[model samples]
Target: MADAQATGPILQLQGVQTHIGPYHILHGVSFEVPRGGVTMLLGRNGAGKTTTLRTIMGLWRASAGTVTFDGTDITRHSTPAIAQAGIAYVPENMSVFSDLTVAENMRLAARTGAIDERRLDWVFRMFPALKTFWHQRAGVLSGGQKQMLSVARAIIEPRQLLIVDEPTKGLAPAIIQNMIHVFRELKQTEVSILLVEQNFHMAKSVGDTVAVMDDGRTVHTGAMAALAEDDTLQQKLLGLSLAAHQ
Candidate 1:
């Protein structure tokens, strides 16, 4: 492992633990997402993957340890403050405003609350549905359209790190395949991403690094290609077949 101090992980979680009500979630989870690529967080349903992401975004407080980004300690920062510091998070439950138009939803995510034509055009290229439904209320969009809106909203402006929770969740095979291409394109933008996903095909396609968590802690951290090619290890960690990932 490269020394996090020197290599500069865009997001670093060191012994982070989280507690939700009476249940202790994230028991000293630790991982590093190096700069300029996707870091796939892979695990079973009950693993602390989502908890770790929420903790990083300050949506959940860490009970112990630290989360640092770009040399600043953000473990105790407020959610809005963390967002201001350049972390954009898209949860599995796509949260587009029901009453707002697709354009309006993107405006709300903007720092100045106004559209940037170039950036909006860039986003439209990734999710063409956004362009088609520019004036339509977000609530009327289909599942895949809503998901695309959620992601478009996040990148309406530049963000240092993008943390996405299962972008392919509940989508049709065709939609999922489209998202895989979108993520592949997003990766080429050179922005760091920490993605929590169960779709191994997309994970293998876009991920450069990998982290496997179980029982509230990271059990493995290495190259995504290596994990994608090792069926035995994929089955052991995620009950997924590496052959399917390819």
Candidate 2:
């Protein structure tokens, strides 16, 4: 990873607030994703992790605060427009076109016309199983393969920041291990990642920094190693004993 302090953040959320109907989902949530590293957004279910990502993607407009990517303000943009601004989001659903073959899904996501051979190579290399199943229908693939296809499709675009929601959800242990390796490989690339993950072990293995969210706001932000060492903080914020896991 690059020197985070020198490059500034790839994505910044400042006092962002959002609501759906009468229900408020985010309240002044703020954090930074440093360039070229995975920043895990750690929180339990219903803590507004997915909501925060959707708000950042502009699926829901923020009622207040600013979102900046690469120094450009994009809080008010639509989802497609925000995506065009170099932010790609992979929602928890894995949104892969199940009817389409793996190759077809990739081709459909190749909106830039010019193929990014390096990016394709990197993705395929990371998930060798994807290359092996290129001609198979995405829907017929295993849960892990679908997740791989989802991530590969997102990375096809020249994304500055990739926001992923619960990538390891509902996967077998073996598949989750493969997904962890894929994420670890992605951290070596230029693209930065903002990951919302429930698997603390996977997150700690791949994430550089961790941000703890609760009740629609970021409560703690620090290096993953430091957070792991703070038993009291881990138990209080994440309700897990990091020492036991370590």
Q: Choose the strongest candidate by TM-score.
A: 1
Per-residue CA lDDT of model 2 for 1-246, tens digit only, reads 345434889888999999999999898998999888899999878999998998888888899999988877889988889888888899999999999889889988888556677877877887787889899989898888899899888887777888999999988888788888888877877889999988777887888998999999899998988887788998999888766753
Model-by-model lDDT, in order? 0.89, 0.86
Question: Local error of candidate 1 at 60, Å?
Answer: 1.0
Q: How many clashing pairs per prediction, in order? A: 0, 0
Which candidate number maximizes lDDT? 1
lDDT of 1 by residue, 36-94 (tens): 88999999999989889899999989999999997788999999999999899999999
Clash number for candidate 2 = 0
Q: Looking at candidate 2, what is the lDDT of residue 203?
A: 80
Q: Candidate 2: where are CA atoms >4 Å away?
A: 1-6, 243-246
Tell how far residue 44 is off in model 1, in angstroms.
Answer: 0.3
TM-score (all chains, Cα) for each model:
0.95, 0.93
Give the lDDT of residue 191 in candidate 2.
Answer: 85
